[model samples]
Target: MNKSVFILPVIVILIAAILSSIFIVDEREKVLVLRFGRVVQTIDEPGLNFRIPLMDQVVTYDDRIISIDMAAQEVIPSDDRRLIVDAFARYRIVNLERIRQATGAGGDQAIAIADQRLENILNAETRTVLGEVTSGDILSTDRDALMLRIRNAAIAEASALGIEVIDVRLKRTDLPSQNLERTFERMVSERQREAEDERARGREAATRITALADRTVVELESDASREAQIVQGEADASRNAVFAQAYGQDTEFFEFYRSLEAYREGLATGNARLVMTPPEDFFDYLRSPNGNVAE
Candidate 1:
């Protein structure tokens, strides 16, 4: 019984000793071994790792990229316009030794320190770069280029703290309430003026077209009137020519005929009175029984 008790205690002690010496370093984690509170070696691979049990210590750090969402900061533009700017950054640990030296050990404190550093860098750099641009530039076409420049500057600034900034993005950019309302009003007025100008131009065009149409109508009517007058004058001249030709064919009859026509026209006029003697030449043609006047 005494021998078995001694053997069981020995086995238990050996197992405890093995468990204390052996430590696991996961694939996604990096372990730093410290001797006398000073970092001696860093184990970056997975599987079993041997340490000096109670004398040596292991410090683990996550090898994954971390995201930090910065709070909104009020920034001023070159035009003296105030805007709220919100941004975020993606960073990862690049140098484990530098991270340990800067943050000391691990946990929330290290993350807080790194975040503070990143925020300071972002604030300082953004202010300097963003201050050079006017409010219009911020709200217009150059915003993307400005963002890229700021991101690159921020990455460089944060690199010395063992924080490798993978990407930086601006989430929101807002003008002040007063500025927004004023801008909206101005835009509305501009659109209204443009619409009014378009309407005026349309009216002017319509008037011009109407006047041209009226002028054309008047010209056509005048041309038709002139053509009608010319046709009537031609028809009258043709009738007169036909009568003249018929009269020229018989001279004596034409003279007798013209004398009778003249007498009838003269008597038909109410302003004249006809009183003729019976033996007069003008009445001789009427009195003669053979229808011939004496010489």
Candidate 2:
């Protein structure tokens, strides 16, 4: 009975030790084995890993990419424009030992310190690059290129932490409220000036069109008057030709017709006087009352 009890306790202790010595390393994690606080082995692959029981300790860290958002920082460009920038960075640990040494912290403390250090590096680089570029570059399509340069520079400085900087990006970039208000006022002034210029141009064009229309109307009237005079002159010429032809054909009949026309006009007005001797020419038809003058 004493032997069986002793063996059972020994077996239980072995099982417990075995269970404690073996640990699982997930695919997304990396494990570091420490012997008396000194790093002994690093397991990067996912599987069951073994360590010295009661002497070795395991520390796991995330192997996937991590993100850190930086706070908004203000910077001035070469053009002396003040701007606010918000950015973020993506990074992954490449060498666990180097990262542990650089951070000088453990577990969650390491991650926090690393993230803070990343922001500091990124901010310094962003300020440096922005100071070299114009404000137009910040707002232009070339902003991507500017961000790439910032990321590259930051990566160079931060590589000592054994982390790879995948990318860095600007989240928001704009001027302060005071600058925006001033810009808005300037834009309004420019638009108003342009509107005034456009209205003046419109007035000038309208005046030109009106003056041209008046000139056209006057020209049209002058042309119509000239055409009417030409038609009247032609009719007069035709009538004169017809009268001359008739007179040449019959002189006596023409003389009688002229006398009759003169008498009718002279008599058309009530009791009107001609104050001339009439029987020799105009009165001949009235006095004869027959074909005697013509015959």
Candidate 3:
């Protein structure tokens, strides 16, 4: 009974130690075997991995690309315009050994430190590149070139820490909240000023048109009045010529016609007023039907 008990305990310990020594490395992960907190082996391929059960520690790191979102930071462009820039980066750990040494940490702590360092690098480069350009360029399609510049700069710095900075992108670039309101207000004011200027110009144009029309009306009326006066004078001269011509044809007939005309006019309604003696030559026509003078 004692022998069986001792053998069973030994077998149990052996099985436990064996199981602990063997680890399965997934294809998505990189495994590191660390002895006394020092990396001894780096297994990148997927399969079975072995390590010293109690003396060696295995650490797994993701082999996939990692993303880091930098906090939004403010940058002042060359034109002295301030902008809030939010950027992100894609990076991968190319050399786990170097990353481990550079971060001076292990496991999750190491990843965190590395991420923080990368974020800092990305932010610095983003600010540097964006600061050299105008805000218009940053917001324009040329922003792709600017992002490439930032990525190149960040890659140079991140390579030291075993990080391959694949890309750097500006996610959002905008004016600060406080500046946004002010910019909108300025735009509105400018539009309003432009509208006022247009209205003023329109009013001036309208006034000029009105003045021109008034002057034209006055000239036209003056021309028409002069034409009417000329026509009236011509008619009066033509009537006097006709009367003189008739008088020269027959003096007695002209005198009788003149008498008839005077009587017709004097005897007209609303104007039949006469204050003359009755036996005057004006009665010659009335005294003789044949219009002879009654001497």
Candidate 4:
């Protein structure tokens, strides 16, 4: 019975010893030991750690980088243009003691507090800084400089919360819905006007070229027609002069030949007629010497 009693107490003591000195620190976490609600020691390296179990409590906090996405906010620029800005930030705990003091222990509540604080700082800083810049400036070649400025401002503000802001980036920056529509409409109208101007210029050039070509063709045709008419007039005058010379060379023979041609043309109707005339004229050739008509 005494042996049993000793074994029971020994087992109980062993169990108590096991429970008292055991602590665990994860690879991605840091543990802080609090004795009677007062910080006694902090364990930064990951592995097994020891502390008086009943008298001390170990609180673990994540040391890895965390991301917080802020909601899209409407901001008015210096030019009074409304824009929707979406942003996010990356942060990590730098000072565990300060974090513990500020946010009693680490969990969703601590993260929430940190997130809210960061967001507030970001919002105020962004509004103040960005409000002084126009929309064009924000989206211009200076955008990188602006982003750097925003990151610096956010880091400066978040430093007080024991959180190190690694980066602050804007996910998107856009004009409001109505402003977008107006901008698109203006761009479309401008493009249309430019196209119309180009078309008009092209048409004018084509018309000028066509008119010049038509004038050139008309001039060539008129010149050719005039040349042809001049040649024809010369040809007709030459033929008439040649005929007049021939007729003047033998007047009597020409008259006789012309009379014969006239008689033949008149007799083609198959009718004959006689007329009295003196034989002394050229018609006497077809008459007898007695002044009577021969055949």
Candidate 5:
């Protein structure tokens, strides 16, 4: 009866020991076995694992991709322009053994340490790479290329911490408020200068147009005066020709008509002086239809 009781306790103790020695690894976990606080084995696959109980320590880490939200950092480009950069990253532990060896801290503690180191690397590399480009590059599609450079640089640095940087992305980029105000002021000044130049050009063109119009007016007035003189000469010539024709057709009637015209012009006023009459001049034409000399 004492042997049966002792065997039952022994069997229970063996079962407990076996259960303690054996460990389960989930597919989502990476099991790291440490011996005397030193890494001995790294198991990434999901299955049963064996370890020395009480002497062996096991630590699990997420084998899946992890994301890091990088805080906003200021960077200065080659153009001496300052910018605020907000970025994020995708990373994973590519070497669990190396990670445990370096930190000896597992789980959330390891992740936190790695995150702090990666953030430093990310910020430094971001500053180094972006500092080689211009501020315009940050605000443009060229930032995609710049980010690729930062990712490559970050991956190189993060390898030291057993973290593989998968990708780096920029969430936002902007100039400082003071820079924005300065840029706006400069743009306004440029526009104002351009406006002034345009107005000056317009004024110059208007002056030229007005001068051309004045010249045209002077030319037109001179042309009209010349044409008026020509018409008056032509009319006078026509009237003299008519008079000559009438004189040639009938000499007596021409003389009589000419004398009557002279009398009417000379005697238009009541006080008109006429020293010659009758015998002295053909004055008889005033009373006779046909001009004749007074006896």
Candidate 6:
């Protein structure tokens, strides 16, 4: 029984040691094997790796690019205008041993430490580079050039941490909270001014159209009245010429016709009464067919 117990313990230890000595590095990972707190080997190839059990420590780091988001910061440009700037950076670990040395930590702790340091470097560079340009440039297409400058500056600083800064980008920029209200007020005032100008123009157009319509109406009415008067005058002239021609043809018959027309018009009223005495010639047309006065 004592011999069996010793053999089982030996087997267990061997198994544990075998498992501990073997490490698997993923395709996206880089590993460091450390002996007694000292880096003994750096493995970047993906596959099964072996290390001395109980004597070596394995630290793994991602080999892919990582991103770090920077907090929003206030920047004062050359124009003395303040801007709220938010930025981010993409980077990859270039040197594992250097990163462990720079961070003074191994494994995942080193990545965290490196990211924190890089964020600080990026923030400082963003401020420094943006401060050199005017606000217009920061807010324009020239912003691409400014971001390139920030990335270059960050790369120089990040190299100390064994980080390769691939790119830097300004994500969002806006006026500060206190300035936003004032900007909105200024914009509202401008819109109101434009609206008032448009209304004034509309009123002017309406007035012009109304005046034109009134003048046109007056012109049309005056022309129609003149035409009516001309037609009436022509009709009266033609009537007078007919009367004169009939009078010249026979004066006695013409006089008789005029008397008969006057009588008919005077008697046409509903309740008309004659109040004056008529001359003898007035009845001459009724008394004689030739309209001569009866002697």
RMSD, each candidate, Å?
A: 6.3, 4.2, 4.1, 6.9, 5.0, 5.3
lDDT of each: 0.82, 0.87, 0.87, 0.82, 0.88, 0.89
* Error in Å for residue 149 of model 1: 1.9
lDDT of 3: 0.87
Minimal lDDT window, size 10, model 3: 103-112
lDDT of 1 at 59: 84
Candidate 1 residue lDDT tens string, 1-295: 9999899999999899889989998888777899888888888789998888788988887777889898888889899989888888888877777777877856456778888888889888778788999877876754778877787898766777777888777788898777899978999999999999999999999999999999999999999999999999999999778768868897666667776887788668588887877677776556767656555
- For model 5, the local distance difference test gives 0.88
lDDT per residue, candidate 3, 125-181, as tens digits?
A: 877888898999998965788988988888878988987999888889999998998
lDDT by residue for model 5 (86-113), tens: 9999999989887876677889899988
lDDT of 6 at 169: 93
Better of 2 and 5 by TM-score: 2
| Winning model by lDDT | 6
- Superposed Cα deviation of residue 236, candidate 1 (Å): 3.7
Error of 6 at 183 (Å): 3.7
TM-score of each: 0.71, 0.77, 0.74, 0.67, 0.74, 0.69
- Model 2 has how many clashing residue pairs? 0
Give the Cα error of residue 38 in candidate 3, in Å.
3.9
Candidate 6 RMSD to the real structure: 5.3
